[model samples]
Target: MPKSLSNSYSNNTQPPFMLLIPQEEWQSLHEKLDRLTDMVEKTQRDSSNCDWLESEEARRLLGISPKTWQNYRDQRLIPFSQIGRKIYVNQADIDNFLLRHRIGEHR
Candidate 1:
């Protein structure tokens, strides 16, 4: 039988094992968690502010086909960044592109 079971059967008097941490170590862990949480929040805020559009999203926003999107890239008509094999555009750049190519009078 296991020591725990033997103890329980024999005496039933042993207290449960407890894990202990020093106050300073616990405080340090809490501080680290807080810092990590702050960093995550800041990252989310920054990403929200500087939104990025993927290739499909840009194509959909422009109402263009994939081939047309590729043509835009080949002709350097749009601003984009290629990371690895994926392309990304800034949301602000897409907005400006639309503004610059507006066809009719604003109402």
Candidate 2:
């Protein structure tokens, strides 16, 4: 192969300004990237759905402040999940928590 036609980029001081990919490979890569993006978006939507309530949301639903909510958690009155720095409680658990504290019930 000629020197000018060589594919090596290590000899250049500056990085390659442009990349050339075959049309077929470019299209395939684009499709794969789109699919991965869709999968990530779907996962985020599913995790952040109404079934999992954030701290402020659950507190608002229960009509309590941050301290009271923390106390409830400490006492195990409700169940929660900690993902990274965010806390979440299941909607059904919130419902059960309220029901357990009911003063009187007909049935």
Q: Which prediction has the highest lDDT against the true structure?
A: 1
Q: How many Å off is the CA of 59 in candidate 2? A: 0.4
Question: What's model 2's overall lDDT?
Answer: 0.88
State the lDDT of candidate 1 residue by residue for 33-52, as single tens digits: 99999999999999897699
Prediction RMSDs, each to the true structure: 15.0, 11.3
> Candidate 2's residue-wise lDDT over 1-107, tens digit each?
45665655455554446888899999999999999999999988986676888999999999999999999989988999999979999998998988888899589
Give the least accurate 10-residue stretch of model 2, judged by summed lDDT: 7-16
Q: List the residue pairs that clash in candidate 1.
A: none
**What's the distance in Å from true for residue 46, model 1?**
5.1
